[model samples]
Each structure stands twice: as C-alpha cells, then as structure tokens.
Target: MIEKINLNNILFLDIETVPEYKNYRGLDLETQQLWEQKTQYQRKDEVSAEDFYERAGIWAEFGKIITISVGYFINKADIRNFRVTSFWGEEKKILQDFTNLLNTHFNGAQHILCGHNAKEFDIPFIARRMIINEIALPDKLNLFGKKPWEVPHLDTLELWKFGDYKHFTSLKLLTKVLGIPSPKDDIDGSEVAHVYYVENDIDRIITYCEKDVIAVAQIFLKLRREDLLIEDEIIHV
Candidate 1:
C-alpha cells in the first residue's frame, strides 16, 4: 500500500489570470473556433492548442493574475496556514515577485505542488508566463524535464481519473464526491475574467483563488485517507 504523504510538504496553489491587452476578445473568439475545429479533426477527445491559446490570451488580457493563493497544512499541527499575495501593477513584476517568493520560501525542499487540473493547465500556464518574463523557474516547477511518474506533482483531476475520465470532473464535483464542502460561493472560473475586466475587482479574484486553494487542500486530505491507507487487519490477522 502507498504510504500517506505528509501534507506539510505539499503546497496548494491557485492563480487569477487576466487578458494581456484590451480588444483581444475578438481574437480569442476566432482562436476558440479554430481550436474546436482542430480538436474535432485531430485529437477528437482533447482540447486543441488553439483553445488553450485562446484561454491564455483571455487570461493575459482580461484575466490579470491579481492574486496567487497558497495553502499548506502543518505537520503534527491542527491549523492550516495560507497566504493570498496580490500582484497589482506590472505583470512582469508580479510574476517576478511570485517566483522570488517561491525560491526564497520553498527552494530545495521536496515539495509536491498540488492543484486542480494543474498538470494540464495551471503549471504549464505559469511556466510559460515565467519564461516570457525571463524569470528563472524554481526546481520543483521543472516537471517537463522529469519522467512522468517521477515528477513531484499531484493533480487532483488525475487522481479522480482512477474512477471516471470521460466526464467533466471539476474541483467542485470532486469536492462533492469526497464529502468536502465547496468554498466557491463567491466567484467561479467562468466569471473570473469578467470580474477582472468589467468590475476591476482584484479582491474578488483573490477570493476565488483562496477558495480554490481550500478545495485543493481538501482533495489532498481525501486522497491521503483513501488512496494511501494501510489496513492493519489484513497484515496482522
């Protein structure tokens, strides 16, 4: 049986993104259409690169990452500490600050970065933006260079795939299945861009990110209890 991973070594993270430029909505629409077409023809079951690009563009323009929320459960402690750091002014500075904080706080540690759909979206998106800004990625973020199973990463979506892979298993859905309460009553993934752009409310974005972090932490707790359990009855009796 797999041993229960110590939650203290894991960092649950979530980011809020915005578009890079104004008037990019039309471009995003066209890209989405092309992505759908390509996916319908090529992968058939996967989202196309164009779709990814469109979402990225929306995030770059309308989705400005106003906040990055991080959560970690302290070992042998009942309290869980979290921080929601805001990135307001320049995108480059924001990314640099986030990266610097990661390096300063979590460098050289054997950390398992956890998030929802992080393997397919969050991690790649953050890495690409960091590269664009010429920021050096921390050692733990270098998952592309590592072997698939060897990567120190945990995506809750992948864990959910053990039972169902075809359906849309959002964080909300997974939390429900695991008997974890949903903390997303304020905002959601769809309204994130709108809040960042139309409302210009960075706090809303940060709140959404905080909810996501909690969801991730809850998912980690469930995974540890269910997938990493060792029954003494089977071994001793």
Candidate 2:
C-alpha cells in the first residue's frame, strides 16, 4: 500500500476481456439485435453493429473476462516485494476462483481493491460480468449501500485526475508519464481481441494482464511519492 494504506490490505488487479462470442456471427440473431440496440450511441452510421462487435469486450453486456490478475505487497528490509497471481481460462471458473480468493484472504473492512480507471471501468465491469455469470458479488466488488468514504476502491486514474472529471488517462499512459515501466512490452489492449480469437493464446493475455497489475501497483507508489521497486522485488506467484 501507499501512504497510510496497509500494504497487505490493498489488492492491485487488472482484467483481460474478449467478446462473449468470437465474432458477430457466433451471436444468436436475437442477441445481435439486442447488442445493436445497446450500442446506438457508440456505433457510427457507416459502421454496423456487427462491425463494432469486436469492441463489445469494453462493455459489460457484450464481453467476458479472460483473466483477472492480482498483486499484493510483501515488505522486507526496506524493500517492498510484489507477488502476483492470475486466474484465467473459463470465465465462470475465473470468477468463482477470484471471488473465493477475495472472500478468503482480502475480505475485511480495511481491505481495498485498487486498479487504474477501476471506479468507472474495471470494478463495474467485474460486477456486471459477475451478474451475467450468476456469481454473487464479493464484498469488495459490491458498493450498494456504502457511503463515499466507506467505498474501498482506489483508482490510479482518479488519483491522477485530482477531481478533474474531464481528465481521463489510460493505465499505459499513466505508467509512462509517472516514470513507471510500461506494461505493454508484449501486446497492448488493441491486439488483445485478435490474440484471443485468432491466436487462441490465453497465456499471452495473462502475461499482459499481470504486467498491468504490476504497473498499477507501481503507479500507486509513485503517486505517494515513494521510491519504485527494483526488478528483483517483482515476483510472480
């Protein structure tokens, strides 16, 4: 954790997603119609919903999570070591396993779930997917009755915004500007759909996802005016 936050109490997470179906044709006609109706604001007059279907993963209704990578801190001798774990493969199994981990280890009033752009995107996307998958929302993901001060979600993007609602920054951009190492060394989000649908490689996406988790954690440290961790301190679990 950065600042007053407990190191172990903060769980840094990032998700990788793809359209629920590989392509537009894979969706049933009724579902396609619904998708078209849902994207009326975003779809251009020249672009049919089918042409825009690949982008559905960005929206909760049309996409499924492929991976959820999380990281936490392990402080040792003035150095903070980060160990990350990932859940991928079947979306339902991933949601179940992630929820179990949250329930077992990070379920506390003090615990927080931190991500870049999480408040508007990741957290809500996860909740929406959990609903679509028929999984119960874990305590950290559910904010139904919590006051603003009680909400434990921390967003690096929001922190960077500093109450500037018009400001929107991507994780990659934040890491770069904040002097944290870029997480897109292998593949970026733009290529994720192609890599998942055409290459059919979940491992690649996992790697990218894990890198984002690490990047988010590092960005948090930077925001707190703390020193960055060396390469040896980053560990994979």
Candidate 3:
C-alpha cells in the first residue's frame, strides 16, 4: 500500500518547540498555579513544577513552536531530488509561514502531510499553535469534524507500529533499528528548550529539525523497499 501513494503528493515535516516562557517565574501568578495544577499527575510529588518546567514545551498550551522544517520529493525525468526548507523566528511568523505552505501547494485531497509520530504530536501541535496565533487552520491541519478516514495525514511512527497500539517508538530508536542515519547526533528533544534559551543557537535547532525531516523521508523509502536518499539527492533550500 505504501508503494501506491505518490511521493510527490506528500509533504514531510518536523517542528521544534520550546516552552512559552523561559522559566516558571516567567509565568503570571495565576498561570503558574494553572501549570502546577495541570502537571500535578505528571510530576507526582517527585519534582516541583518549576523543576519540571523545562518539559512544558511538550504541551500545546505551554509551548511555542520555534522552527518547522519540511522536505518533499521531486522527480523529473527519472532524476530524483529532495528539497528541504525551514520557517523560523517568531512563533507567530513560523506558524503563519507553515500555514501558507500548506494552503498553497498541499491543499488538495490527494496531498498528504507526513511526519514521525505526527498523528499524535506534530499535527495537533501545529493546529493548536495556529489557533493561538489567531491564524486560520489550513485544510491539512484542521481535523475538527472529519471522520477518521477523511483526514489527510500520514504518520511514519504509526506505520511502524503495525497495529500494536500499546507499543511506542522514538524517532531516534526507529531510525537506529532501521539503519537510517540518526537525527539526534547533536541534541535530542529534551535539550531543545535549553538550546533555544541558554545557548541561543536556533540555527543548530533548525539543522536538527531538518535532519529529522530527512530521516522520516528515508524511513518511508526503506518501508517501501526503495533506495534511500543519497547525500547529493538532499537539497537544503
């Protein structure tokens, strides 16, 4: 079935996010209380809300997307290439630019958005951030009333699950087992917030995000029993 889908019609994406505020003190008193209440179970009396605040970026309400990297395949006359690009800077601008990409090129029924564990994370995170920024949801991210089958999203993580809903796999681990190049050679998701706040190197994060996008594309190729992308075939645009 994977071979039946058109690679050109699919847009592969990955996003890097950080906590909305640098620290717990950055939040207003009322919002701080809300954060404590919201994460009570996750903290489980083991760590204070302030101590756990570094991970707040995992939640849509408490986080902002810093960068979104996307890659798509282009084949012309049997010459194959993949182009990758990123939208970075302010959160609102990032969301707006990514929204524009979706609305412009991949808005058709035949177009699909692919990501690793995106059905559970990336897809909804983008939608929530868009709404927070007062941007209209694009057709690809707007999944309000559509039936399950009507959604035009594809998840490489889900595909690897193979109906084992109880199973979970991290992108890094999946890539390792599948022999795809690792995307986390520099920093993992846990360090994204720190890199953005303390190190102040967003360019590093953008490179990491793009690598994840390329890894996803490569994983799809492997799943389809096709050749993986060569270094020369990946273009950073």
Candidate 4:
C-alpha cells in the first residue's frame, strides 16, 4: 500500500507546541486546580503540578501550537523538489493558515498528510486546537465519520512498527537507524517551551520544525526504497 501512494500526494508535516501560559502561576486559580487534577496520574508522587506544567503542551486542553511546518513534493521536468513552509505566530492564526493550506491545495482524495507519530500527536493536536479556536475543520483534518481505512493520513512511526503495537520509535532514533540526517542537531521537543518562553527564539524553533518536516519526508522516501532528497532539492518558502 505504501508503494502505491505517489510521493507527490503526501504533505509531510511537523508541529511545535508550548503551554498556554508561560508558568503555572499564569493560570487562574480554577485552571490551576484543573491542571492539577488533569495530570494527577502522569505526575504521580514524583513532582508537583507546577513542576509538571512544562509538559502540558502535550495535552491539547493546556497547550497551543506555535509552529506547523509542512512540506510537499513537486515534480517538474522529471526534477523532484521538496518545498517546506511554516505557519506560526498567534495560535489561532497559525491554525487558520494551516487549515487554509489543506482546504485549498491538499484537500483532494489523492492528497495525504504524513508525519512521524503524527497520527497520535500532531494531527490530533491540530484538530483539537482548531476546535478550541472555533475554526472549522478542513476536509483533510476532519475525521468525524470517516472509516479507519478512509482516513487520508500516514504515520512513519506506525509504518515502522510493522504490526508490533508495543514498538515505539522517535523520529530522531528512526532517522539514525535508517541513516537519514538527524533533525535534533540544535534543540528538541523538551527544550521548545524554554526556547519559546525564556530564550525568545521563535526563529530557531521554526528552523527546527522545518528540519523535522524534511526528516519526515526523507524517512518516507527511505521507506519507499527511493533515493533520499538532496540538500539542493530542499527549499524553504
């Protein structure tokens, strides 16, 4: 099935998210209590809610997407180029711009959205954030009544699992094993919140997010037994 899908039909993507507030104290009393209750199990007895707040971005109710980088293949004159772009800044605007991209270009039945572990994280995060922002779901992201096989999504991590449901692999690890360029040269998911809140470096984060998109695309190419994208073939727009 993977071999049947055209590379041009896949929109490779990655997202960076941070907590809704910079600090746990930033939340009102009611929300603070809610956060405590929400993460009770995850935090357990190891850490306080304030200490655990940094991970809140993993949950849609407590976080917002800062950047969503998407890449697609374009073949002209038998030359293939992978173009990557990012939607960022205010959460709502970021989501709206991403939704516009899907609704406009990749909404066709042949188009698909792909990422590493995105079926579990990026896709659902974007959808929940869109709903929170009151933005209508684009056909590509809307799974309201779609059957399992009807969903136009691909997950590199799931593909790598090969029916071993208990198996899990990070994009960085997968890239290393598969010999693709690593996307974690600078910062990683654990540091994104600090970079956004303390370092005030969104540009760096955007670069990181775009690299992840490129890595995801490259990984997909590897899985298809195709040649990896050359540096010259990757364009930022």
lDDT of 2 at 94: 93
Greater-TM-score candidate between 1 and 3: 3
lDDT of 2 by residue, 106-196 (tens): 9988889999888888889999999989999999888899899899889888889988999898887888788888999899988899999
Candidate 1 off by > 4 Å: 1-3, 25-64, 77-89, 163-167, 226-237
* Candidate 1 TM-score over all chains jointly: 0.73
Selected candidate, larger lDDT, 3 vs 4: 4
lDDT of each: 0.64, 0.90, 0.94, 0.95
| lDDT, model 2 | 0.90
TM-score versus the correct structure, for each prediction? 0.73, 0.96, 0.98, 0.98
Query: Model 1, range 9-51, lDDT digits (tens) per residue?
Result: 7777777775554333445676556545544644435765444
Which candidate should be chosen as best, given lDDT against the real structure? 4
The order of the candidates by lDDT, greatest first, is: 4, 3, 2, 1
* Residue pairs clashing, model 2: 1-7
Instruction: Supply the TM-score for candidate 4.
Output: 0.98
For every model shown, the clashing-pair count is: 16, 1, 0, 0
Task: Mark the 10 consecutive residues where model 3 has the least summed lDDT.
Answer: 37-46
C-alpha lDDT (0 to 100) for residue 150 of candidate 1:
73
